[model samples]
Target: MLESLKVLDELRLNFSQSGLFILNLTLAFIMFGVALEIKFEHFKKVILNPVSTLVGVFSQFFLLPLITFLIAILLRHYITPTIALGMILVASCPGGNISNFMSSLARGNVALSVSLTAIATLSAIFMTPLNFSLWGGLFTEIYSRTDASGLVRPLEIDVGQMFQTVFILLGIPLVLGMWFNHRFPDLTKKIVVPIKRLSIVFFMGMVVMAFMNNFDYFKAHIKYIFLLVFIHNAVALTTGYSIASLFRRNATDRKTISIETGIQNSGLGLVLLFNPKIFPPDLAIGGMAFITAWWGIWHILSGLGIAGLWGRKRKRVVTIQ
Candidate 1:
C-alpha cells in the first residue's frame, strides 16, 4: 500500500498539469450531479433558514481566519511568517470541493452543501484575496513594528489578478458544472459518481507525490506543520459546531456547515504556492500543501467521530423525549 501510494504520488507530480485538469473536471461533474438533485423548493427552504446560513457564513468568512491569525500571532515566538501566511491562506480559503461528496456520504443536507460550495466558490474570488490581504497585511505590520529592519515586507498582492484566476479556474468550472446538470442530465448522472471516486484517488495521489518530491523539506517542517494543522482543523470544526448550535439549526445543517468549513481546497493553495510572483521556490507553500493534505485525512476521522457521537446522543434523547 505504501509503495502504491508513492507511485501515485510520483504520477501526481508528473501529471499535475493533467491532474489539475482532472481535479477541475471532477469538481464540475460532481457538483453538477449535486445541482441536478437540488430542488428549487428545497433551496428556498435552506435560504429561509437564515440563522443556519448566517452562522455558517460568519464562521467561514470571518471567524476562522480571525482565529488563525490570532494563533499565529500568539505563536510568533516560534512560527515563521511563511508558516503564518500559509495557515492564513488555508483558513481564508473557501469550502473544499469535496465537501458535497462527504456531505452526501454522511447523509447530511446535500442541497445546502451544494449551495454553500457554489456560493463560497463564487465569493472566494473576492474574499480569498481580500482576507489574505487583511490577515497578511496585519501580520506584516506587526512584524515590521516589532522586528525593526529585519521584518519581511507585507505580501504585495494583486487582488484583481487573483479574482480573474478564480473566475477562470473556480467560478467557470462551477458555472459549467451547474450548466452540465441542466444541459446533459443523463450523461452527468451516468458519469458523476465514477468521476468523483476517480478524482479523490487522483487528488490523494497528488498529495503523496507532492510529499515525495520534497520529502526532505516536508520532513523538516512536519513537526510544526502537524501542530498548526491540528489547531487549525480543530478550530474550524469546533467553530462550525458552535455556530450551528448557537443558532439552533437542525442537526443536518450542523453537519453540513461543519464539513464545509473544515475541508479546504488545498489544490488551490498549491497553485498559489507555486506562483513565483507570490514567493520564491522552497517557500512556505510546500508546507501548506503538506499540512492541508494531511489535514484532509485527519478531518475525515474527525467528522466521522462527530457524526457518530451526534447519532448516539440523538438516539438516547429520542428514546427519552
Candidate 2:
C-alpha cells in the first residue's frame, strides 16, 4: 500500500505546472456550475431570518478567527511558527462549497448553508487577508523565539488584486453559471453533475502535484502540519456549534453553522500561498496543501456522523413528545 502511494505521489510530481493550471481552471468551472444552482432569493431570505444568518456570519468571520488566534498563541509555545501560522491561514478561510453539500446531507437548512458560503466567500476577499495579517502580525511578536526560516514574506495584502481575483474567479463565474442555468436549464443540469465530479479529480491532481514537488518538505513538517490542522479544525467545529447554542439557534441552524465554520476554502488558500512574496515557506506550502486536503476529506466524514446524530436525536425528541 505504501509503495503504491509513493508511486502515485511521484507520478503527481512529474505532472507539470500546465497540468496544475488546468486543474485550477477545472475548479473554477465547477464553482461556476455551483453558482448556477444558487438562487438570488436564497440570499435574500437571509434578510428575513436575520438571526441565523447574522450568527453564522459572526461565527464564520469573527469568532472562529478569534478562537483560532488564541489557540495559535498557545500552540506557539511548543511548536514552530510556520505550523501555527498555517493553522491561522486555514481557519481564516471562508466556508467551502462542500459545506453546502454536507449541510444538505445532514438534513440541515441547505439554503442557510448556501447563503453563508456565498457571503463568506465574497467577504473573504478582504477578511482573509486582514485576519491573516492580524494573526501574522501577532505571531511576529513570538516568531523570533521560534526558528522558522522564511516565515515572514512580503505580504502587502493588496485589496485591489484580491477584489479583481474574486470578481473573475468567484463573482463573475458564479453569475455566469446562474445565468446559464436560467437560460438553458437542461444543459445546466447535464453539465453540473459532470463538472462537480471533475472538480474533485482536479483538486486531487493539485494535491498530488504539491506532494510531488515538495515531498521532502512535507515529510519533515508532517507532525506539526497534522497537529495544527487537527486543532484548527476542532476549533472551527467548536466555534460554530457553541455560538449557535449560545444564541439559542434551532437544530437546523446549529448544523448549518457547524459545517460552515468547519469547512474552509482551501482553493483560495493555495492561490494565496503561490504568491512568493506572501507566504514564502515552500515546506509550509506543502504542509498546508496536504493538511487542508486531508482535513477537507476528514471533516466531511466527521460532519456526516455529527449531522446524523443530530438528526436522529431530533427525531427521537419529537417522537417522545
Q: Name the top lDDT candidate.
A: 2
For model 1 the local lDDT of residue 104 reads 65
How many clashes (backbone atoms < 3 Å, residues ≥3 apart in a chain or on different chains) does model 2 have? 0
Error of 1 at 29 (Å): 7.2
- Tens digits of per-residue lDDT for model 2 on 198-223? 66666666566556666665665555
- Tens-digit lDDT track for model 1 on 60-114? 9898889888987886656556566778888888877567766766657777787
- The candidate 1 region of ten consecutive residues with least summed lDDT is 1-10
Question: How many residue pairs clash in all the candidates, one count each?
Answer: 1, 0
- The window of 10 residues in a row where model 2 has the poorest summed lDDT is 4-13
Number of the top TM-score candidate: 2
Assess candidate 1 and give its lDDT.
0.66
Candidate 2 Cα lDDT to native: 0.67
Residue 275: error of model 2 in Å?
3.7
